[model samples]
Target: MNTRDLLNRRAPVRRAPASNPAMFLFGALLCAAAVAVTYWAFVRTTTGQLADESAWREAEGAMPGTKLPVLQFLDSLPLLSLFIAGAVVLAVTIKRRRLAPAVIALGTFAAANVSSQLLKRFFFDRPDRGVVTLDFNSLPSGHTTLAASAAAVVFLLASPRWRPAVAAVGGSYAVLAGAATFINLWHRPADVVASFLVVGTWTLIGGLIMLRVTPDWNYWPPGGRGRGTAPVFAAMCWIPGLLALVISVGCYLYATKSMTALGSSEAMLLYFWSGLGLIIGVGYVLSALACWLFSIQAGDQDR
Candidate 1:
């Protein structure tokens, strides 16, 4: 068959109009920032003092008063659950004739897993406490990352008609996973925050990639035209990107005890808010720029 005939036969084979190389580059830069943050939070904290001793004791004291089935489940199958969930999502997507979404979800899961492992290995050292701790590499909690990544992918693949509902479900899962990890004393609050950052950034990148592969899929706005330029695509991505940033900042502030503990001498409240404001501000500006650039490109193309 001629090239044109093959192209006609597989009309959906073309790269997603939304998957701009520039976006991929932007995503990479964000991932790098996440990695740096993870290193600083996990690695740097581990060095100063094996605070795990006090942290463990505190955890034990706190554990007696709490009943957490979800935490128990998380401790029992930290990494395993994510893989199983990813497989199930992939299977369901295939059955529904939405193989691309499934593939995108699974692929993102795999990439996140590998990245977590690499980070763990690079910063290998046994936890200063917790005899029952899984293995080396405490920074950027893998369990949390898996949960967030899977939840984000599920949100992306959900039908536009059901996107909000699906996003709610995914958000619930992500929260449960984070709580489970924290209550079980498996990961520090900072580790959980970093996980959200890294996994979330990658998930957005994956969604953008999927957009490129299927521009007509209308992954946003619940029933809008799929074939559009970068601006529309950027707008679709911006929602989740902003959400991720908001969640990350909230997690960081809460985990670091910056929001609570008012009227205390140790209140570095201003510092926390300042840092969070800067990150959020930069993220918003970048997203706006992406949208503007895409809009300009679309306009020029029309002309």
Candidate 2:
């Protein structure tokens, strides 16, 4: 056999089940749980409102004399760019017969965004929950939702070989977009977090739908050139996520005493930065989780 033929013969083909009922059910459960938790946290609990308000106040000019036009720019990222990128990625990566999955994945973005708006307007009611804030419920910031949903859809459209890289880049973008909301005082930490969860839940459901439709298209080849990208992407995600968690914990520990008094400006600033770090950490962790959840195996290809 030729060298190319020899390699193909030696390389193992990955395989996945025709339908993953467990993953689909798990995704559904996760989506429901996220919605419940978000609603309970933002609308049902007084402590939730208090914590949210404190975070909001700290984020909104906690340092004083600081202006964040750049944050504003990040918060105002255009949705059209997201749509265009999704279209381009789908065009390049998806096969003609596999177009249905891509279309469903892209539609997930719109569904997720609309859900956030509807939840904010109709379902989540902030009726004098003891925390001082605006009248409207803002548990899930619309901007953060849009950013995170965009990231999630991109991940869904990516091939298994490219998923890790997409996850890393997309997670970073989502985290920055979330942090920008906090920095600009446009949303509380909880708001951004809820948005992430919302996108994650929807992405899970959408991914399962894709997997169900394109069971044969999602696999990795042994000894493939693209094999390296997955592990590299995982490393990138874990390192930053773990570091951010450590930093957030340390900051919280350092500021604990001052937080009781709610008096020290330094403490508040520390908390603010720590909260931002936590957002980054959580975004990446969830992105990584989503990648894991959507992973499916298929028969080996001829190539």
Per-residue accuracy of model 2 over 1-303 as CA lDDT, tens digit each: 798898768554455544566766687677668767866875678765655565566676664544457555663575543765577556755455556766777778888889888888887777787656787778788888878887777777777777778888889888878887887787877778778878887887787777777765566554444655666677788888888878876765666655532324444566676677778877888876665555433233434
lDDT per model vs. reference = 0.53, 0.71
TM-scores, all candidates, are 0.57, 0.82
Query: What clash count goes with each model?
Result: 2, 3
Task: Write down the worst ten-residue block by lDDT for model 1.
Answer: 294-303
Off by over 4 Å in 2: 1-19, 62-67, 93-98, 221-224, 249-268, 296-303
- Name the top TM-score candidate: 2
Q: Relative to the unseen true structure, what is the C-alpha lDDT of residue 26 in candidate 1, on a scale of 0 to 100?
A: 76
Sum up the clashes in candidate 1.
2
Write model 1 residue lDDT over 148-242, tens digit each, in one string.
67766665565443444444455555556765665566665555555666665666677666666644443333223332444444554456547
Report the poorest 10 consecutive residues by lDDT, candidate 2: 294-303
